[model samples]
Target: MEETSKLQAEAKPMIYPSNGKAKEALINEKQPEVRPVRGSALRQVLVAFVANIGTINTGMVFGFSAVAIPQMQMPNSTLPIDEDQASWIASLSSISTPIGCLLSGWMMDALGRRVALLLVEVPLLVGWLLIATAHNLPLLYAGRLFVGFGSGLVGAPARVYTAEATQPHLRGMLSALASLGVSFGVLLMYALGAALPSWRHGAGVSAAVPLVALVLAAVAAPETPSWLIAHGRPKEARCSLARLRGDVCDIDGELDQLTRGTSISAGDGKSRSDMAASKRQTEKPEPLIKTLFKKSSLWPLGILVAYFVIYQFSGVNAVTFYAVEVIRAAGIGGGDSDYLTAVAMGVVRLAATAAACILMRRMGRRPLTLISSIGCGVTMLGLAGSLAYLEPGDFSILSWLPIVCIFGFTITSTLGYLVVPWVMIGEVYPARVRGTLGGLTTCAAHLSVFAVVKTFPYLQHLLTRPGAFCFYGCVSLLGSIFFATLLPETKGRTLQEIEDYFTGVTPTLGPPKENKKKIKSKELNGSVPV
Candidate 1:
């Protein structure tokens, strides 16, 4: 333990490319240590507001493609397209996410969050421009692919930025804000699709929102302090800490904590000279894949993947994609049925996710997830019953019942499942492996989405609507069981604390065993508490 303390004391921080540049700039300025400003609450709110713009932009682009596919079909119009070709417009975007995630992980580590975000925004702007002026099928597909790539790039960084910027206690609530942004974006898309007569206009409007968000993100957002520290710009990292916390009373202490918390000591059998040389020459190792294989990480990864798979398997994409067909099958006669259901689901999701923002902090993650999983399962079963038993053209019972089930599923989903799983992925891993592991888990989640969205129509045709819902119901129940058995509670714990829990490492809650001597001296000298 004494040896470990000495090594930690001598440890040098890792520096990324941007950190060196920032330090060079700071040398010429001679800036004072940045003090935390007043009105931290207001600043936090503003940061969340700006960060959510990225989330909203992502959802808007995703939702627009769903709304556009049927309109682009244009029945009997002889555009020389088949179902698979139309489906590619949406699938291409989903497939691009893993690639974008891999790239974003590298960029976030190298360039800092703000610059990485700017890179994502550039693609979105160009993609939206292409989408707005898409004259043919190829251009439309290209536009969708670019937009999807941009959205995927934003996902990991947006979460990382939001989580790193907030206080420990506030992390869950603030992190859930990204989900709220997605909900609102989806709602906006549904509303626009209903309100507009032309699909082109809806696509154009979707393209415009992200272009506007790109401008806002570029001008206003600050780089994450954690990213700053990782790059070796300790002074700028301190300034960023001050800006986010808005308090100076314990700024140095807080910085010390953050620095110590993130630092990784070189392993046994390495002399200090060798370690120092290694640090100077080598990049920070990416341990993400190896970490995922650990017994500690494997269970969480499984639970999270199951959560994502089940969430998608709830027939969300199938329903969203075929809302018009489902409504008609349910005996709803109006042409507006699809739009109405889409708008309703979006509204309910927004409200439920907003409620989750409040409840997740208060109620904790597990209970909310359990309730959502069970609720969605039961609701799906009910929908299957309605589909199987309801007589044809029984509009009163058929129309309202399925609509209620859809709303129930959407509401339950937002309350815990979708956003919380992503937040847990960010929280569970060590900083060394967080990005890569998170990306891998996210890839699994999204690949399930791609599979479901692409195949659900075929499944429905093969098994009928009732049979598909029954399958969804069974999968949801299994997910609930998985959550009950495997998912750990993460509320109110620091990242280190959560890491310790997963790794089966018992944390010293009080002073270190060897710190007793220092503790006595500090008390004798009237120094502040450790």
Candidate 2:
């Protein structure tokens, strides 16, 4: 036991990159560490954000169901579908997302981030075209399947790209852009669906989004330097870093950190022959089942799994997939009122996500999530009460109340729970297994999403709408408490700092002093203060 303890205490951090020669050159101590300018680093983030348009295409695809379903069921429409088909349409994206995640992991590792993302656009573009031209149900289903595959695949590379490409300080805010892009995509369709004469009439428009993404990804985006280094292309890695560094030709400290895992102090000059004998000896990664149990890996995987459970059960999918049904059930008839309300909610979610840029920076992640979870619980309970107590006739007079509560929930969820988990997913893991772990967690989360979306009608049938909401409310309330007790603050810190927190190492960068004091004081008060 003492020997085990001593061994643990004496352990050294592993090197991250696979380039044998670069590893030796990377540790050269004669070089001075260049502190990358915050202003310059912020600009590098723009490339990742532009490529994130692919993520927006995902939201557009899901939003298509919201608008297309009713049109597909129209009496005079060319391809009206039954309730079963509509349900299948809504749930298929979730079904294929997991499969896409698994395959995307391999593609990301094999093809590189930029090329893998470009590959993602191929199916999404073709799928939209198939959707645009389809006259029969099979073609429509096949198109949806392809789009689902792309959506599922996009998450890992998008995450890996943003996480690897951005400076550690800008990581959280930039990562939030993925979800923000998703909201924008959803909002575009929400507005477009309401404006277009018919869903089928959206020709030459819907496919434009992914095509733009494809073009931008190919022309504007840079390959991640870390991926380049891992593949033994240090010259390309150096070039990628120089580009990301903005007007700088020399690779900075961040590049060394990437290649070596931990930051290394400069070593004295060594003979070129000494460096020549170096060879990379990275161990083969374990299988996914065994990978799940590592101390560093387990926290992120377990928490994300729980987060998805709480997230999906928050009724986001149900609310989005059946916004019209929800309003109609609340005694408002399906028509202009329902679509307008959904657009309003979509706007709310988008606006809140935009605001999250500031909130996450100001309040930090744990606080935002706690606030979001608790507020979601409260709003959901209010929705349940509104449904249970309000008379059908009285809905005309007080019809706006439920919308207000939903807006409130949107404010809360988007501020924290909706986007932060994803940000952490990008931030929390070691780069060695990041792709594999990313795929697995995303797949699991989407599977939960599928289960929740498919069961919405059944859940409503079993508990009634009000009862279903009450269940979500109670679950959210519990989720808030769980976060309060356990979720670590991740905002404003580097990925290394967050990993250190999970691994029980002293965090290299702690929160600002005022923020730390505020967090502790809030915890002492028995609430996770936001």
Estimate every model's Cα lDDT from 0 to 1. Answer: 0.70, 0.74
Candidate 2 local accuracy as lDDT? 0.74
Winning model by TM-score: 2
lDDT measured at residue 124 in model 1 versus the true structure, 0 to 100: 74
What CA RMSD would candidate 1 show?
11.6
The TM-score measured for candidate 1 stands at: 0.80
Q: Determine which window of 10 residues in candidate 1 has minimal summed lDDT.
A: 262-271
Score candidate 1 by lDDT: 0.70
Task: Please list all clashing residue pairs in model 2, or write none if there are none.
Answer: 29-266, 29-267, 72-80
Off by over 4 Å in 2: 1-39, 263-293, 332-334, 395-399, 507-530
- Model 2, span 1-530: residue lDDT tens: 99998776665333433577666676764465443233265556778787678888777876778878877787888998888888888888788889988888778777888888788887788888888888998888888888888888887788778888887557777888888988887888777778888775553377787788888888878898888977778888877877776744235555665665542211233322113212212445456556556777887778877887887888877777776677677665457777787788789889999898667667788888888888999999998988898877784656667766777877887788778887777877756567777888788878987888888878888999999988888989989877887677766556655565565454333643434655455334432101
Clashes of 1: 2
**lDDT of each residue in 1-530, candidate 1, tens digit only:** 99998777665332222477766765745655443212265666677667667777666765775667656676743233567786677677777767777787777767777777677777776777787787788887788778777877877777777777776557888878878887888888878888998666776777666676677778777887766766678899888777776754345765665565521111234533234335534655435567557865765667777778877887666665555555666655456667777777788888998899888789878899888788878888888888898877675645578767867877787788766886776677655556656666767766776787678767878989888888887777788877887777887566655665566553322233354566455435532322
